[model samples]
Target: MTAEPAVVAPVLPAALRERIVAEFPKYPEKRAVLLSALHFVQDTFEGWIPQAVVPEVAALLGLKPIDVWEVIHFYAMFNSEPVGRCHLRVCTNLSCCLRGARGIMRRLEETLAVRPGEVTPDGNFSVGEVECLGSCGTAPVIQVNNERYREGLSEDDLPGLLDELRTRLAEQDAAKDEE
Candidate 1:
């Protein structure tokens, strides 16, 4: 028996939904289109993937919402919850793990005081352990909001980077406050 299609009113901005829908034809199959669609939704949302938004894509392509949901759940890069302003995904694969990924991760947890998959209270940072980022050469690398910073990460870089990001966030917050 077929399941009922979810009634999802897309919260995605019309422009984003239209743009992503335009790209669907270039893909080989409708299933293949899901990953890119999920990325689009995340980017439009600042950081997280909302399942409710899938219905809009489904409506556009005439696919089932469950198909979109399955793809989102399958990929770790796609987050279901609202994350920090900057998403930090540290590679925990063999190469990164062998180098100093473990130590880096430990320091991140301690300094951030939040375990993997948890966002900081300030909503400025969220850290998660991800499989190989294909940056084995840069063992212990982290992909921050899609930008990868590499090389030897000392126990110190964790807090230092966080400080910089927080300061940037603070400045932006202040600007928002002024407005």
Candidate 2:
């Protein structure tokens, strides 16, 4: 059999290494920490799991880098590239679409001035079309930053949501300025 090329692991910060190590005891095996480890690493990389991060995670969890990549690619929540500081994920599944999700998405595009999968010019927000967000009852749901989801959103609600996001971004910018 032909030998595979050696993989170069990247140097992760002490804190990140510690976080991954900390997750070890919570699971049955070291490899079980892969998901949470990916989350920690992704946060440190500014909300995206970069190619270099895969090998770093693998080295920490005693798995192959391709194993790490498999998890990253399997999950929709994981981003391979940089996304906006805030993600605007609108569910366009059967339930959401039947409930005016398309119109809501259109309004968001007009307001944010970016198409699906594209980040805004200022890096404040990005639009994405996701499948079911597991809220069929609340059809037409829009998730923000994967933190919260606003359900039953109508087209008119778009303006207020965008304004609120802009306000939050401004507040964040102001806080950063003070630091």
Candidate 3:
């Protein structure tokens, strides 16, 4: 026996719907647009892809919920749960590890007061380990919010880096509030 696919009503707003639809022509098939659609949906919500949007994306893309889930589950970029405004993904791949990635991870956990896979009390930061970010030349790299990378890290650099991130998060919050 199997559970029925969710009967998810359309939740995507007109703007986002248009954005996803606009990408249709660029792809060979509607199904091919799933990845971009997921990215748009995730960006619109938070850093993570909400479960509700999974069925929604499937419906819009003319695919099954399972199809969407497969992509989401396979991709490290798509978070199933809400992450902090600052999602610090430390690369623990071989090159980074050899270059002191573990020390960087420890410093981040200690400075943020949250272990990997946990959000801070203030909901401003979270830490997680990831595979190669493709910056072996700049080993010990940490990717922030999937947008920027700080490479060649040192334990001594942790304090200032964390402080900069905190300030940036605060600024982002303030800008959001102004809107």
Which is the better candidate, 2 or 3, if ranked by TM-score? 3
Best by lDDT: 3
* Residue 36, candidate 2: C-alpha displacement in angstroms: 1.2
Compare candidates 2 and 3 on lDDT and give the better one: 3
lDDT of 3 by residue, 1-179 (tens): 99998675677878889999999999788999999998898778768888877877887889999999999999989888888878899999999999999999988898788987788888889999999999899998988886878988888988898899878878988999999
Give the whole-model CA lDDT for all candidates, comma-separated. Answer: 0.78, 0.85, 0.88
- Per-model TM values vs. the true structure: 0.84, 0.87, 0.90
Per-residue alpha-carbon lDDT of candidate 2 for residues 100-159, written as tens digits (9 for 90 to 100): 998988888888889877888888889889999998998889998757789888898888
Question: Number of clashes in every candidate structure?
Answer: 1, 0, 0
Per-residue lDDT value at 142 in model 2: 91
Order of quality (lDDT): 3, 2, 1
Cα deviation of 115 in candidate 2 (Å)? Answer: 1.4
